[model samples]
Target: MENKVVKVIIGILVVSVVFGTLFFWFTPVKDGKKQLDQIKMNNNYLILLIQVINRVLKLAILTTMKDLKIKLNQLKFQIVLN
Candidate 1:
């Protein structure tokens, strides 16, 4: 039950991050040197944001995997004892 909740939360987070990244990546920039320059600056910030989001995603996946591994090990121990 708890695991299902965690999975749902992670799924939502992943979908949101993917959609947000795609939205930023495909957003149109107005035509002009000044506008282009401004977009380039904003792109840098967006890139940083993307990197942070990717890191968060990686951390969440790793944590979830670790938790599953621990739970599996605990279950194995219980079975052995029983």
Candidate 2:
């Protein structure tokens, strides 16, 4: 009975190892490389979008400042009560 159990256990281990080796050796490698490339492209697109938004905000702030300066120059301050 003990010999039977040992043989069964060894058989199970050998089968498991064979399956594991086949899975690792025969798996497609291109799918992983494609996924990595897609992630990198998405990251580059996001960076470009952020840079555009920053440029637009800078232009708006500068225009607002110019308008404010012009309004300040037009205002008159007098302390005379007559």
Candidate 3:
């Protein structure tokens, strides 16, 4: 049950990361400064939400990868002991 939950969460994060990457790539930028100014002026909540989601997804991926590495190492140790 716990494993299933983890898998689902990871899947959601992966999807969010992909969508965020595509959105960032497709978003128009004008002179860099104008982009920032436009975001500020337009009160772009969607951009802010995307940024937050991307950041959270990145952190979650890093954490999940680290956990998997640790589990793999533990499995190797157990095999060695056996």
Residue 32 local lDDT, model 2? 82
Clashing pairs in 2: none
lDDT of 3 by residue, 1-82 (tens): 4456656766786686678657755678878897777566445645666676677667667777888998999999999999
| Candidate achieving the largest lDDT | 1
Per-residue CA lDDT of model 1 for 1-82, tens digit only, reads 5557656766776676677667665677677886677667667866766776676667767777889999899999999999
| Model 1: number of backbone collisions | 0
How well does candidate 2 match the true structure in TM-score terms?
Answer: 0.53
- Looking at model 1, the pairs that clash are none
lDDT of each: 0.73, 0.58, 0.70
CA shift at 27, candidate 1, in angstroms?
13
For candidate 2, give the lDDT of residue 23: 55
| TM-scores of the models, in the order given | 0.59, 0.53, 0.49
